[model samples]
Target: MTAPSKQTVCIVDDDAQVRRFLAEVLASVGLVAEQHASGEDFMRRWQPGKAACVLLDIRMPRISGPEVHDWLRDREPGLPVIFLTGHADVTTAVRAMRLGAFDFIEKPFNVQQLIERVNQAVRLATDKSAAGSGNDGWQRALTRREREVLRGIIDGKRSKLIAAELGISERTVESHRASIMAKAGASNAAQLAAMAAGQPPLD
Candidate 1:
């Protein structure tokens, strides 16, 4: 069993079956799971500083996912939220992204994809907790391309491979890498990687 201190992948959906299925999926990958039936219920039960990330349903009774996200931004900004929507639209997706949701995925989502995203979110939460609040500002400083490069670096790709994957030159990849390091206030690649993973730099 996961200890109480272990991070949980929390699911907030109105449908009981969906919640059960999600919980089971998370368990299949050895991740701890928590579930709530509605947004209001989740908000009422949620405690600040818990080691958890939320998989929020877009449409729910009492409060919507975006509404809950707004509330969380003010209360537990460190908690990462990923939106799950059965009826996805451009406007809703845009709004969710604008509000800083970790990611907005459509329902009937691929199981593997969902698991991967959950794993990434959990890693992010763990990092944020370890790195302290200043890390959030560094993350926000990255541009879209720089963010992609940072992820590539975290995946252990070299500049050459990242360039090929991103369809850019090796020189361009290096430039992006340097920019990411600077924006993250990292003096070396190791420190930048630690920052990207939300870990405090090693002394």
Candidate 2:
């Protein structure tokens, strides 16, 4: 089989050791790593259509990871972002995911798992680029109610909880979930979530 073309994974963190360690790990798996010492440095160098995915540290010296993510959302909506966070930042990381982050990994991460998520993010970015405009078509096809259900799903809410919050029945929530998956051409929640990374922020 032919080898895949190397893709760059941008590592934006204040810690030099973390960046170097992550770069080495990514390199071991045939991926190239681009290191940035801080979020400010990353923002200065970043442009649209660069890097397969970003490994962003949640807490940086300046222009924190969430801030960078917000900037990316406007300019490079299709680019995948995987937050690197500590245990205390898990809540913030989950909020980021709800707001369209590709994924988040806690510090002292598992090397193999991190590699797997990065590869998935890269594939997602490639697919989005190939699809030309990401999930806009299907996202546009969704009704306002469906969008609400999708937001709940992206927020990691269970059907019963979503139903309660939305003042709908559990069955209705499930139906909306099914319709969402169908519209997104996703077979499961994870696939739907991956595609949701490209979806616009729900009102």
Candidate 3:
């Protein structure tokens, strides 16, 4: 869980007391806390690889929490966010999940529960970092041309359409696809699509 010493956290919420309360609790655990009053403030100061997690309020006066998440999605911070929702919903929660929030904590969460969930989220983020290092070799296994061909295959393109785009023969496209499927351990278009999207092998 990053040894607790090296991790920094950000508590982003509009409420002054929310920020202070979070900051104190985090300090008690030997982690760093940098508080911000709004999503924009957090985004302005945020560095990509620095923080471990964000305790963000889902509602704020300007630059709401969900927008802040969308901004960070491309940044790909090691930071996993546990959202604070004053008015939680099935649809809003689902959107947050789809956008890759670590967890959704309803308002008035217990101190121990928040701490436990944060610890779990940090562990997950660290595991993802560890696993990525081992897959560096596969990162370059496919050439640019091969990737484009794979995309076509996943899109259910006929060999002729792919070939015409790449200025290659349909037979050549087929041959390249065969090689791709074998290397990716995929049996069909759906499998190929999953691989292309960087997903794990389907059961």
Candidate 4:
């Protein structure tokens, strides 16, 4: 039998140095890292269903990371996208996460953390591909309140913020969050966010 192909991680950044460094790091972990010098370059070269995950730089020229993410959402809804942002870009990154990004890593990130997040993203992508429409069951099982709380969590909102928005107590929001996780079989918010990607809007 032929061996399974390595998972590909596409790194889209304006800085050549950043792309090279990320390529080296991902390669060290047995992942195939495809580097793109700019968002436009990535857009041109990217093919649907080609990459398991994307490491997108948030502050790129022209297309920008969020813009590229929008394109990805429309084209490859199931592909995980992890934004690479600087300290100042954290807010923007969080907003992107709300829109279905897998996760975000701030600049000067720990190598181990990056590897863990990337691995998680790859696993999520692989599981999603294998499951096909299987995820629909869990999604259908979520209560409307659970779904609303889940949308807040995926948006990177704090429990307090979600509570305020929903006009419920923080404890209530936490309860909904726990229920959502249990129903979705997700151990954490990141996994929940990944599973929710491309799903219908909770609203």
Compared with the true structure, all predictions reach lDDT values of 0.72, 0.78, 0.67, 0.78
Which pairs clash in model 2? Answer: none
- Which segments of candidate 2 are over 4 A away from where they belong? 1-6, 133-203
Instruction: Name the runs in model 1 displaced over 4 angstroms.
Output: 1-6, 132-203
Which lDDT tens digits does candidate 1 get at residues 82-149? Answer: 78987645458545553456666687879989988788767666554454456466566556887788
| TM-score preference between candidates 2 and 3, better one | 2
For model 4, where is the 10-residue window of minimal lDDT? Answer: 178-187
What lDDT is reached at residue 83 by model 3?
84
lDDT of 1 at 16: 98
**Candidate 3 lDDT (Cα, whole model)?**
0.67
Q: What TM-score, computed on C-alpha atoms, does each candidate reach?
A: 0.65, 0.67, 0.64, 0.69
Name the 10 consecutive residues with the lowest summed lDDT in model 1: 178-187
Q: Report the Cα lDDT for residue 195, model 2.
A: 82
Arrange candidates, best TM-score first: 4, 2, 1, 3
How does candidate 3 fare on TM-score?
0.64
Give the winner by TM-score.
4
Flag clash pairs in model 4.
none
